[model samples]
Target: MTKRRALLSVSDKTGIVEFAKKLVSLDFEIISTGGTQKTLTDNQIETVGIESVTDFPEMLDGRVKTLHPKIHGGLLGKRSNEEHVETMKKHAILPIDLVCVNLYPFKETIQKRDVTEEEAIENIDIGGPSMLRSASKNCESVTVIIDPIDYETVISELSETGNTTLVTRKKLAAKAFRHTASYDALIADYLTNQVEEGEQESLTLTFDLKQSLRYGENSHQKASFYASSIPTAFSIASAKQLHGKELSYNNIKDADACLRMMSEFKSPTAVAVKHMNPCGIGNGKDIYTAFMNAYESDPVSIFGGIIALNREVDAKTAEKLANIFLEIIIAPSFSEEALEILTKKKNIRLLALEMREQKDISEKEYVSVLGGLLVQEMDTLVEDETTWKIVTKRQPTQTELEALVFANKCVKHVKSNAIVIANNERTLGIGAGQMNRVGSTKIALEQAKEQLDTAVLASDAFFPMADSVELIGQSGVKAIIQPGGSIKDQESIEMADKYGITMIFTDVRHFKH
Candidate 1:
């Protein structure tokens, strides 16, 4: 009987010596290449060089080592087919029972601060993927292993039964394909990022599973979290949880919304979110004051919401946050005393992020439809007031201009058909996702009833008709701001002029779906 043969070529040399020793103990001939063979021989484990099997030396800087027909024939030959056995025997090719291969650290290399395009290209593995695919294609005759964590399991199975089960081989084959696909995606993403204008017209995105969540938006729906392979500094996927319970699906979604809202302000800002919409948002002299102002925006709606702070959490703010029934709190950092006080709430999830002065936004945003994807550039353009037109006769005061800009920023993140009522950099009422513009105006007006006379209202888009303008004007909305692109813009401007309401046209629309 022929002794079992195993080929090992890996960049991550984790537990290779012990695994090879176990295979040698099982009466298997260990065939290895380059560093793997050197390590195995250094550890006194018997092994044969891969060149001995191929009858050729590794050349072209180790790129042409495993593309030989001898290696692939051994992996792909079928033992049950007599013709394949005859062909293999005629070529004097011995069957390889197991293949253990892992690619180079392409992802790791590209993450280096000073890495160049040429360096990234050089790290891409060629022969490693070829051998793994050949073995995976003939999984019924050969076992393929790519992850180091599976070494013990394979050793245990071979020790007990002298071979791996078909089920195990199939599962490993699936993982091998996933591994290669992820590797190729990383290479593609890196190259795409380096391409200049007019060179490539599309982007390739890939996400690796980060973790399996308990459920999706609802408890009954299954879900998992996948993160971009390219590293980022400000994404919620990379946040470090300092204390408290694991974040749920809803918690992550709400936290992301809260972060985006908070990112709109340069000053110390706070945003509270519930059900993927901002319940409250404010900027103040300090983070604690900002938190208080945001909480005051809507005390009832912020009860079980997530809070995001753009500054470090101090002891005073943490004490205030502790009193509320918040599901999550995300901040740049936390004072030691603040962490001590906040950790008392065992169920509240706490995350710490590194605040960046200018966060990088990806160019494309994808929304999945029934049978396709709706792709668009990210809505990251800054609204320039210099480009705005003051259509109404009355010019807005400095205070009104500040309030209008603040409200406009807040409304940009709200759902479509949105209206936001704000004053002094604080959101008083936000009506979002309404079917009609009048309905949203009514909701925001009612929420800011007490402050309507002093508040400025911001409409995410032009009022389709003059009814929305009439509604806000009658409700004592001191000023109004909108994109002003509707064909009936004159009608809305006339209504604002009639009511002496200051109106400005940004000439830019922000319609969030």
Candidate 2:
């Protein structure tokens, strides 16, 4: 009978000594490298070093130790082949039955505030990834472990059955490949960003699973939540769910929309989102007024929608929020009274997230299209009247200007062919995802009703023709704001002048599809 051999080399020493002790108890010889050897030997567990197996000392700052053929041939050889066993006997190579290895902490090191290129480059692991790949490729005979969380399960199975099943080995092998692949991707993305001129032709993205949802957008589909590996303060991935049921796919999408819309305002703001579009948004002297204004914008649309506010939710605001059947409510914090009032509703989800200015964590956005991907830089540019071009005879009044800015912010989050009509920092009506500009205008105006006379409209993009302007003018809207880049821009401006309306061109277009 021959003793099975296990190789253990890990940067994270979590539960390694106990796991090694379990293998020793199972009559397995443990071979380790560097700190792993030191820790195991210190814990009264017998272990052999890589220097003994390869017959060479670790050199070149500890990079050349595990690249020897003796180490790799042992991991890559097949036990099913008679010729493989004969060759191992001829070369004095011992087969490695199990490999426990984890790569360097490149992702965590690069996340520091002042990490340099030299520091990041030095943290990239070489021998660790090589060993993992070799062992994973020969998973028919070798078991590979990359995550420390799986140590207890693997140990328990080995102790009970004297070996891991083939199915468990295959699954662990797949996980090992993904672990090394993600580690390499982080290094690739970091180096590419160092170039000052242009971006890399290909995109490398990595996300860690935050939680698995009960289902996707539909109950029949599967779903899970993934957070960007890059760190940032203002993301749903990092939000804390203070109470209520688990989040669904639709809840996450709508909550993100509400947060983006809430980021547009400096004052106390509240935004209500439905189906990934802003149904109502408002700002006021206090968060209570903001909540009521946004809720009253379109009460029917706000039902079952998610609400996000920029300030701490108070008892008054929580009372109003609990009045309707809502899906989720997210804010920076909740007052004691507010929590008491809102907690009464057992099923409504309450999330607490401190809002911050969103820095460019990743400057690019990727969308899958058919067989390939479409990539573009994120739209983080802030647009205001500083670069606006007012194209109408009657300039907007002070009050109208404020309303126009608010409406523009609300419109940016709406789908294409979107129209948002607002008054006194509160959205009066919103028409989103329409086929044509006139159709959106009619829906927004119809929803505003008597408020149309004093309400202002914001277009997400330029109106190609004058039909939308004429439609809003007939509805008695006093002011309009849009991006003016159309060939018939003069026509739209003339139409605005004909009806004695104020029109401003932001020169920036925000088209969200």
Candidate 3:
């Protein structure tokens, strides 16, 4: 058999010298370009420049080096086919048995502060992706390596078998394709942001596989996590799971819900999530007390729920959490003792995330339907109190006002057509995922029982009809907070006036689904 030919071009040169030396000892010819060739030659390893093999000089400042027909003819040629072999011979092209390439650091370039548009555009690689795709498409004959961490494994397999296995080549080819696709996505996203203002074009999104779950929402379905290359605040995709059994689909869903809720508060707060809904939420003097209050709000609901805290986990809080049979715990930080204690429970997932400012209130929203996705701007900001106009004779008391605010915050996180009734900063009843406004109001009041008479009501959106307002008055709710954007707003206001109920128009909507 003829000696195998290997092409090497990489931005990260870690362990390349030793790798190339071993390849040379094995009688594989090394072909590289630019900085990669310089590094290998300086290390006393004989190397041939890619320009020399292609018989074409690097042009456009090295961007046109590997795009030549000679490089691609070698990578794409099929060894088993006589036609392909004859074509390569007629073109004076040598077969490339292996390809090792990594793209330019577009992510690093875009992350730099005050980076110009020119700088970002320059980092987009042309030749690198073309070479990677060419090699990956011919995985039946060529082995492609993209990640540097796999260098040792590839070398070991090659040494033991005298050639890279087909299975290994296929796996590496898949990785290379994913790498190039993600790179293209980053470039598209960056350029899209530079377009004219008020551009309504959809954002091009791409994500890499993070992990596969044991199952989806149920044991019968399958699920997997895909993380974006673009970072976001309170991202579960970036979370480091310190300990646990493999995270299930439900665990990840609830953890994500808890993280989003906890990110909304500036003061120390804790939220308990179960089945992608907030079971309990509270703020206190410190993290420990806050967690205790949140747990007490609905202990039965929190039995196996996920907990997220905005503050660091201390030993005291950790001790209390350790006593519960919880599924997951997430916080910005955890004390050394706390982590040590928590890790003892092998089945609980503990995640530590770097704290960041809450995502922009105007970020895009997405919902998955049976066939496609529904996209809109996230309805995040609650109505400012200054804009609220009381349309009734009765005014809410200071305590009732505070309770209304708390209830509004809770309702914002609930599913659309939602109502939350609260008293003394505790959620007395939450009616969520309902079809109509009146149905939600009835469910909330019925759940609150006797406390419904004294509690304040918060609606996620405006009452389309006066029946919702009348329903609240019949329950003896003292104050009502709503966005007040319905066409029949006058009818609702008149109904509130007749019932002596204090109603405020916020001019902001909080629809969640």
All candidates: CA RMSD (Å): 1.5, 1.7, 3.1
In model 2, which residue pairs have backbone atoms overlapping below 3 Å?
none
Provide the TM-score for each candidate, comma-separated.
0.97, 0.96, 0.88
Off by over 4 Å in 3: 78-91, 149-171, 196-203, 336-346, 359-363, 450-454, 487-491
Error of 3 at 275 (Å): 1.5
Give lDDT per model, in order.
0.89, 0.88, 0.84
Per-prediction backbone clash count = 0, 0, 1
Off by over 4 Å in 1: 197-204
Higher-TM-score candidate among 1 and 2?
1
* Pairs that collide, model 3: 416-512
> What is the per-residue lDDT of model 2 for residues 227-308, given as tens digits with 9 covering 90 to 100?
8777657877778999999999889988877777777777888899999988888889999998889998989999999999
User: Which of the numbered candidates is closest to the native, going by highest lDDT?
Assistant: 1
Better of 2 and 3 by lDDT: 2
